[model samples]
Target: MTMLEERPLDEPFAADPATARRQAATSPETADRPRSISSRTFDDRMSLGGSAVASLCLVWLLYTVVLPMSGKLGFVLLWFVAFVLLYAGVTAVSQPGPVVRDRIASAVIQGGAAVVLLVLVFTVAYTFVRGFPAYRHLNFFTQDMSSAGPSDPLTQGGIKHAVVGSLIELGIAVLIALPLGLTTAVFMTEIGGRFGRIVRTIVESMTALPDLVAGLFIYAFLLIALGQERNGFAAAVALSITMLPIIARSADVVLRIVPGGLREASLALGASHWRTVWSVVLPTARPGLATALILGMARGIGETAPVLIVSQPSAYFESNPFHNPMNSLPLFAYTGIRAPDTNSHTRGFGAACVLLATVIVLFVVIRILARQRRARDARPRPWTRLARRASS
Candidate 1:
């Protein structure tokens, strides 16, 4: 009370005039300073706009100014290089070094993907355009080359025999390769041991073996050694050989990636190893296995040398795989294109288009099957439903 009476009560709380002025001057400077890097925000729209504008300008400049001087052959390369550099530089102006680097990398990857998609679209469009003349004729799909001469119009000839042969041979090849490949994959991934390693090594080695070599092997074994005639069966054998390694290796990799905990859980629940693999592992990896099969089919279906070497290309329909020569889409296209006639050339293109369509159809079917499997897996099983009902 004595001390408070000695000095005014407000004196202790009041700021000195000089210190208050210094604080007032420093506050604005502190507030105006730039934020830390962690607090900074990037304008993605601005970056994207700048990148697009720079890419367009660079492409135009090259097309108009640089092409005359440098030639048009390297336009794509130049454009790619210019766009990447310009985009990176533009981003760097507003972003940190790491962010700029990431942006550049993403741009390059996206550009490459776009280029690939464009190339695929262009190829399909060009093939369809060139083949439309023959494809438009209904007979081109209903008749055989045997009934039509080289001088005949597109309406007179078709790929019926080749289509039949191709289907029969590919069917045989898949029937033989699928089970063997799946078993080998299971052995490699689930039953890994010394034998599995040896099998894996052999599969890896076989993957690099030439298609022609496989054809020659089958040709020698079946036609030369066994004194058998050229037939669709022999062609199917060669195709199976070519397809086996592809399916086995791809499936092995797919199966290996299936969660080990699932297998352990199954085993702990008193299931046998084989049962666990069949019920749990295979079901989990079925979609991936289907993809592997598709790859195998794609590799085998387009092979001309194997079918050409092992089976004589037939012009007439021959459904028997074991006795007589057989025709296929690849052989049909090859033989047709060799004929010195415009109609024949058109037929060849038409056959190629048909083959392409067949592949597309197969891919769509496989995708649908995969989607159905995924949907089925997402639904509760009957046992699971029963268990839930019992619990309730």
Candidate 2:
């Protein structure tokens, strides 16, 4: 047989299964046509379609199909939606099989989402920037809010009393919530048993309790205990009730993320558990703890219902927390909203902008400090060495 006439060895052991299959699949007339392209496309489309159907079913099952059996339906729906989206994303990435078109499509989708998000952010920023300066003058924070009628623009009072009251009440609220929440978190994370379960249940229940319910509970209970009328202190206490559980749960989660190995190491060194927790775990989780507190405060700071029930809004500054119905930023916004003048509404918007900015700035500052602290901790122990040398 001639070398060209005889089948090549490569043909017998061809690496391309499709090529081999094509040769086997076709008669002499049909050998020119391809087979794999349509088959692969069909497989890809089938996989993607199956994924899409499954994803849709998952989304629907949680959101539309299922009845709310537990109070946690929102959380379950959240997870279900996340899972569906993730599955869809995986399917999209895998089915396309590294094609340049898929990459381009992904980029375009991402860019569109980014553009939309940027537009929303810029719109918010523009409104705040424009409205903020309307009341950003020095007098805005300095003058008394007393008897400033809507018609009198020049005599319109500053937010001095409200600002001071807010700061004082917030300070008191933080002092109350921080320790209680931190201790609760420590207990939840460090202790185990049926007690842990109970604590967790209590925290979770507290988390789900309505803010107005909390306000009413505190207003009834604490007001009776203290034998006092509604005042700034009562408002602070009400705010603390809503804030504490959140801080505890969040801090507990953060503390749980601390490596058990760290605690074990400290224990192995003959350190007391309490000491180890205080010196090691607390420090490690400090950033997250700070973030949690800041978040809790942010949640409570804008609260109107609780304050309205527990504290009366006053125009003049009052240093006595127990006797005086103090002016608060939220109360100021409320009055401005209900007032008849456009100027008052503008002022309210300005205050709202300030309040929003304050919360955002605190969150950002918390994150920045956390990062800086982590970096500082990560730095070489040169300072320790220097301290040791000095001691020697």
Return the top candidate by lDDT: 1
lDDT of each: 0.86, 0.75
In candidate 2, what are the lDDT values of residues 1-392, reduced to their tens digit? 88656877655544565456435655565677654432446545665456556755665576655855444556444544554455456544433344424533553576468668978898778657655744667677677678676555733677778777877788889999999999999998998578988998999899987889877887788777767887889989888988999899999999999999988876766677787888779988988998899978986888888888888778787877888688788888888779897777766766777677777787898889988998887777675553443233
lDDT for 315 in candidate 2 is 78
RMSD for all candidates, in order, please: 9.5, 10.5
Across 290-388, the per-residue lDDT of candidate 1 in tens digits comes to: 999999999999999999999977888899998889999999999888989998888888999999999999999998999899888878768665334
Instruction: Give the Cα-based TM-score of candidate 2 against the true structure.
Output: 0.68
